[model samples]
Target: MKRFTKFVFKALVGFLALSLGLVLLFKFVPVPVTATMVMDGNGITKNWESLSNIDRNMVRAVIAAEDGKFCSHDGFDREAIEKAIERNAQGGRIRGGSTISQQTAKNVFLWQGGGYFRKGLEAYFTVLIEQIWGKRRIMEVYLNVAETGIGTYGAEAGAQRYFNKSAASLTPTEAARMAAALPQPKERSVVNPGGWLRRHGNTIAARIGSVSRDGLDSCIYE
Candidate 1:
């Protein structure tokens, strides 16, 4: 039992050191690939862009559509998590309240899908990134690594694939459409969204202005 405990302690220390080194390395270096991209059966396409090159509208649209409190939250949003839990308890599709930070951590360091173990690792990495990467780096990594469509990853790739344009030049409508598709990119249509998706895209487009006006995206700019 003593030997087993000692081995566990050594393993835990090794994990912390490895994870911290990776986080610090990625702080400056653009991530080359992710487990999600690797595990994808569909061929992956991505182009890493500096946050400066990716249009501000794209950032605002995602903040509006995904997490309104992105700039304010520290890696986690308790209220959103609580609401998701309450909704899940009532029974239906499982909803998540992951912030851009948490999503960035998962995209960069972990895999897709959920389990208690994965969620715990996600929480651990989320804290590491929030401390090490800051809001701007977290947002940059999220936009660059997130799977945007079937066989597509990143804003640059998504913009080029869907609109034949650069991510830097995405219009509000285009950015919002992409943002709307992000939650379930393969299932949602960014090019010709209909029904709730179209409505959601429009709503996100409108809210992008609010995100800018209210300075909800100030942290990324800062």
Candidate 2:
């Protein structure tokens, strides 16, 4: 029992230390190998570029698709988590209850994997980033690091490759499609832009109004 306690303590300390270090590092340095996937008969990786209007609308689109309760919670939303648990208990696809904050944490800090250990780390990192970074910054990093295509890494890269423009130039319709491609990024043909992609994109675009981007101004102060 004592040994187990010691191991847990050490792990917690290590996690805190690593999260603090990453936050400091990100503030000062652009990551060396940040990537985005693109299509030109074939897909390829390219550097990620941060954008100016990685704004409320874009953030809203992501929240609409991923986590709509971002602004209300501190780091985790217990109610939603419980609801997901209930759904899974009744036989669902085992969807996560992660918020945008959590997803950003995974994209920027943790590796891509589907396992208990990785998810635990993702949760730890998510909580840390939310407490340290503001909501806007969290969304910014998410937009810049999230995998958009088979190999695409950020919105800027996705924009240039998919729409032939900068991230800031993304229209509401385009942003909604990009946001919708997130959950099925690899299988959904984001880079290749196939028929299913167009169809799914349109579906997400139709629900854009429900996302409530401007309504989140309240959480801005939090």
Leading candidate by TM-score? 1
Residue 218's lDDT in candidate 1 = 91
TM-scores of all predicted structures: 0.98, 0.77
lDDT, candidate 1, 35-133, per-residue tens = 999989999899999999999999999999988999898889999999999999999898998888888888899988899999999999999999988
lDDT of 2 by residue, 122-152 (tens): 7877777777777767776777777777667
Task: For model 2, name the residue pairs that clash.
Answer: 36-152, 36-153, 37-152
User: lDDT, candidate 1, residue 49?
Assistant: 98
Query: How big is the positional error of residue 210 in model 2, measured in Å on the Cα after superposition?
Result: 4.3
Model 2 ranges with Cα > 4 A deviation:
1-15, 33-46, 190-200, 210-214, 217-222
Stretches of model 1 off by over 4 angstroms after superposition: none
How close to the true structure is residue 173 of candidate 1, measured as C-alpha lDDT? 99
